[model samples]
Target: MSRRRRAEKRQTAPDPVYQSCLLAKFVNKIMYDGKKSVAQRIVYDALEKFAKRVKAEDPLAAFEQALENAKPALEVKSRRIGGATYQVPIEIPANRRISMAMGWIIQHSRAKAGRAMDERLAAELSDCFNNQGTTIKKKDDTHRMAEANKAFAHYKW
Candidate 1:
């Protein structure tokens, strides 16, 4: 880690269609090998599919809700103090919470077999919106672990 002053966060432009920086960040996370256009197409197609599934509901709103549902309130961090390492329960930072939710969503979607990327993403988003999906499970697990390790929370810096 650098000892210098923390660097300022770079600003990200919102997605053209949705006008949402959050959605743009999600698209950037989905991009691989610098293929941003391909990533954008996949995300847009998935959002369209999701919109079709829920009549009269905006896909962007659904996506935001899904991300909120999947966000972990607490997480355990390994901290070394003196001679022993302890799992310290800590509240997640806001930006990190969003990033982690998006990561889990994409990760679980990629784990599905025999499906196109767009379809898999759509399914994952829908499931997340309903609060019943792999991402939600992962979030629950994190909270559980943090709860179990609450005794060590004082070890947090």
Candidate 2:
């Protein structure tokens, strides 16, 4: 962490094809070793696959809905007070919620075997859109943990 100053958030330009900043952010997160073009291709292909499966609707809409479905409302944070550790429930900020959803979707997609990256991502996205994927399950688990630990929320400060 930087002590002197908060880091400035670099502005991200919307993707060329979809013209969406959120999608651009997802693509950036998907990028590795600075291979943004490869990431873009993968994501675009995945969206196309998702569109074909769903039929009669925009894939971008499905992507956004999937992310929204995976966003967690609350999460637990560990805090120490008086030699005791507690799990404090905290509300998730909007930006964090989106980023977490995106990360989980990518992570779970990567975990699947025997498929190309685009196909895996498309499958995961479709699952998420229908609220039946690993990412949604993870979000539900986080909410459950937070609900269970609500008594410790006062220690959050």
Candidate 3:
């Protein structure tokens, strides 16, 4: 809530191999301590494994579908009106939806034990593509919360 002008949206450059902006963004999200090369290697490896796991001829398409499946359409936001706090349902914007999906996928993948990051990510992606995984479960939870809070949506400013 800065008083300054809104920041302009910066366009991400497409990834070198897939020429996909979404994939590039996903790689950037996976990067830690600015080690983009390591992140890219891991993500690319996961994509390959995911393609083989799902028997997908187009890994990018499969990955996109998995990401889409993990994206939540609605979320609940807390709004304070007349000294009362309420949970207001809100539609998520496009960029937030994509980032949330990527974050959830990465976080859920990282939580598993006894697996490399790439292998875990590949398994999670395939599970998500099939509409059954932690990410998708999180998405469903978000939608459910939003639905339950629909009565408070009028409190949105």
- List the RMSD of every prediction in angstroms: 1.9, 2.1, 1.8
lDDT, candidate 3, 26-121, per-residue tens? 999999999999999999999999999999999999999999899999999888888888999999999899999999999999999898999999
Per-residue lDDT over 80-122 for candidate 1, one digit per residue giving the tens place of the 0 to 100 score? 9999999999999999999999999999999999999999999
Each prediction's whole-model lDDT (CA): 0.93, 0.93, 0.95
Q: How well does model 3 score by local distance difference test?
A: 0.95
Model 3, runs deviating above 4 Å: 1-4
RMSD of 2: 2.1
TM-scores for every predicted model: 0.95, 0.95, 0.95
TM-score, candidate number 2: 0.95
Worst 10 residues of 2 by lDDT: 50-59
Assess candidate 1 and give its lDDT.
0.93
Write the number of the candidate with greater lDDT, choosing between 1 and 3: 3
Candidate number achieving the greatest lDDT relative to the actual structure: 3
Model 2 C-alpha lDDT per residue in residues 60-124, reported as the tens digit of each score: 88889888999999999999898989999999999999999999999999999999999999999
Pairs of colliding residues, candidate 2: none
TM-score of 3: 0.95
**Better structure of 2 and 3 per lDDT:** 3
Quote the lDDT for 117 in model 2: 98
